[model samples]
Target: MTDSDTGHSPVWARSKRRRSSGGGGGAFFGFLVFLLALFGAVVIGMSIKERSVAGGGAAIDGWIATGKASVMQAIGKAPAAADVAVEKAGDAAAATGDAVQAEAAQTADALKKQ
Candidate 1:
């Protein structure tokens, strides 16, 4: 009998063909990788947003403190300014009285000479 008539084939002569069927585990693994990447992106975005909110809160606090300090400074200066204004007014009144007295003395001396 010819060698082909026997059911046995030599291992070196056997077909090494592969099937062209649907992608099995590789496609599922790729989909899992995509989901993991999406999850990572979401986590990063949330982290940035949280940091920004915290920073903004601190900045607002600083502005409020500055405004309070300015108001306190203005309040402290008000009484000093008032005291200076009162002193100046008293001085002006005294000067006006002295000028009137000097004019009366001049009129008396001129009448005595006449």
Candidate 2:
């Protein structure tokens, strides 16, 4: 706690110097923010189309349209994807049950033969 002799740096200055894991969290958050901004632009794209709003560059408009379409398509496919996932899970469970039953039957047969 004494810093007079060596005049070491203060605790506050040295504290939390280690770099925490970046984990690309910044990139992910940036992408999310960009997505949200583009979605906002899509909402206002109507105004742009009708010239009620300005700053409607083709690239920005394209980004808005693409984001909107991707989102809507994903939303439309989600239910069907869930249904397929459920069906696959059921199939896997049935297969696992059959395998367990077959193993038990084999074990019983082996014990009887012995």
Clash counts for all predictions = 0, 0
For each candidate, what is the lDDT? 0.78, 0.82
- lDDT tens per residue, model 2, 1-114: 477678887776666443345677868998999999987887588566756555445556777799999999999999999999999999999999999999999999999999
Name the runs in model 1 displaced over 4 angstroms: 1-51, 111-114
Clashes of 1: 0
Deviation of model 2 at 70, angstroms? 1.4
- Candidate 1, residues 1-114, lDDT tens digits: the string is 766799767665554322224446768888999999986675566557657655655655677899999999999999999999999999999999999999999999999999
User: Which pairs in model 2 have colliding backbones?
Assistant: none
Question: How far off is residue 53 in model 2, in Å?
Answer: 9.4
C-alpha RMSD of candidate 2: 7.3
Q: Whole-model lDDT for model 1 versus the true structure?
A: 0.78
TM-score of the candidate numbered 2? 0.51
Residue 14 lDDT in model 1? 58
Off by over 4 Å in 2: 1-3, 6-59
